[model samples]
Target: MDLFTSARKEDIARGAPLAARMRPRTLEEFVGQGHILGKGKLLRRA
Candidate 1:
């Protein structure tokens, strides 16, 4: 890839959340906050 392309990609990566960089593509794949965010919870329903 060209230098411009590489720089742009690096910028995108740097700008993203650490969670997004780590790779969980769906809510089912997401982790943490089970006390509030788990299935059938009021927050999840909202």
Candidate 2:
């Protein structure tokens, strides 16, 4: 099935709490864990 659609994103955001909705889209946007999550890190690739 073709998941990860934009419509689904909107639906999820609509149902999510304000804190969850305000969360970052990627690890790069997320603060902390930087010492472990540097460029080409295993977690980033995962």
Candidate 3:
């Protein structure tokens, strides 16, 4: 990533709430909520 893009992302994250900043950027990094996101689930399939 370029320095400008990296700085922009860092600035955005710094301004966000802790919860928002801590949220997983990808489904693979997510946890819990298995009832909806578990394997074979409709949302997971989508």
- All models: lDDT? 0.84, 0.80, 0.87
Ten contiguous residues minimizing lDDT sum, candidate 1: 24-33
* C-alpha lDDT (0 to 100) for residue 2 of candidate 3: 100
lDDT of 2 by residue, 16-35 (tens): 99988888887788687876
TM-scores of the models, in the given order?
A: 0.43, 0.44, 0.46
TM-score, predicted candidate 1 vs. hidden true structure? 0.43
Residue runs of model 2 more than 4 Å from their true location after superposition? 1-16
Give me the displacement of residue 34 in model 3, in angstroms: 2.5
What alpha-carbon RMSD in Å does predicted model 1 have with respect to the real structure?
5.3
Over 1-46, each residue of candidate 3 has an lDDT whose tens digit, in order, gives: 9999999999997999999878898876778778888889978899
Error (Å) of candidate 2 at residue 17 is: 3.1
Better of 1 and 2 by TM-score: 2
Top candidate by lDDT = 3
Model 3: lDDT equals: 0.87
